[model samples]
Structures are given as structure tokens and as C-alpha cells.
Target: DTAVSQTPKYLVTQMGNDKSIKCEQNLGHDTMYWYKQDSKKFLKIMFSYNNKELIINETVPNRFSPKSPDKAHLNLHINSLELGDSAVYFCASSQVGLNTEAFFGQGTRLTVV
Candidate 1:
């Protein structure tokens, strides 16, 4: 029973392939998010869905799309993945307040060859 978890902690692939990263949270939080941690360790929020409704959307590539089936899970699906997408994809969650601390998963490192 983890608060937030992501699968395939490491990912390495070719430049033009399709891949997906899965995220899940069991903290009973209404808002869940996806973040991309670059080589510089900069954590940028990609998508945030609250109660199945999208709230925060960042400037990400069109090939990268986030799908949330429910409040407990959010998944990232990438099509025609590029080398630029080679970064650590993290799943995070936080309460609907800035004061709340955001929790993160171990992350999946997607490497495009």
C-alpha cells in the first residue's frame, strides 16, 4: 500500500516508438499529477486531474498525452517518442492547496535511443 507508485522504474527505447507510464495513488487525494524530471533535475508538472477533471496543463509535446480513468490513477501515453522525451517521468499527488506537500513516485526513466 503505497501513496503513489509508478511502474517500470527505468525505461530505455528507440527514438520512434510508443510507450506508456502508469501512475497510481492511494492517499485518497482528489488531485493527482504527472511530472517530468529532466537531466537537470528540474521537476515540471505535466498534467493534473482533480476528481477526473483536468485542472493544470503544462506545455508538453503533443505526442505526450495523459489519461486519467479515475481519481486514483493517471497514466501517460507517448506516441512516436523522440529523444527529447528521454527524461524521468514521475507521478505525484497533492491536496488542493499550495501548502500541502506533493508526493512523488520512484519515476520511470524513458530513454529514447
Candidate 2:
């Protein structure tokens, strides 16, 4: 009975490789988000999706793409992965217009060697 779930909990790859991480939620929420945690342990929002529509944050690099196939799923694809992209990626979900806490996935730690 997981509220949020992400695939490939650990990923290690060479530089310039393309990879994707997937996320899904069973909480019946309308909004979902992707966040990145850097090596220094700082977290930032990378992308957000509401009801299958995209709402990207300006600070995110163009190489990272978030695709929401439906309200319950949001997948992240990174092209030309770089060392700077190595981080713990998290997927979270919250109900629309609610002041409640967002549920997060276990996270996928991506390492570019």
C-alpha cells in the first residue's frame, strides 16, 4: 500500500549516457513533483506536473525531462547524463488545493561515473 513509488532505486552509469527513472502514486492525487538532492544534501524542485500537464521550473536544466503519462504516473528522462546530474531523485504527490503534506517515494540515487 505504497502511496508513492519509484523504480530503479540505484543507478550507476557512465557519463553521456541516457537514462530514465519512473514514478507512480496510488494516493489519487492530482499533483506530482520531481525533486533532486545534490551531493551536499540540498534538495530542489526539478519539475512538477498537475493532472498530466507539465509545469517546469526555470532552474532545471534542459537535459531533464518529466513526462506524466497520466495523473498517477510521472517519469523522468535525462539525456546526455553528466556528473553534475548525480543525485538522489525523488517523486512526490499531493492533492490539489490541499495544505497537506506531500507523499514521497523511496528515491532513486543516480550516479554518473
Q: What are the models' TM-scores?
A: 0.95, 0.95
Writing each residue's lDDT as its tens digit, candidate 1 over 1-112 gives 7889999899898888999999999998888989888999998989889998888889888898889899999999999988889999899988887688888999999899
Error of 1 at 67 (Å): 0.5
Residue 60, candidate 1: alpha-carbon lDDT: 80
Clashes of 2: 0
lDDT of each: 0.89, 0.92
Give candidate 1's error at residue 55 in angstroms. 1.2
Worst 10 residues of 1 by lDDT: 93-102
Per-candidate Cα RMSD to the true structure, in Å, reads 1.0, 1.0
Show where candidate 2 strays beyond 4 Å: none
lDDT of 2 by residue, 1-113 (tens): 98899999999999999999999999999899999998888888888898999876748888988899999999999999999898999999998674767899999999999
In angstroms, give how far residue 65 of model 1 lies from its true place: 0.8
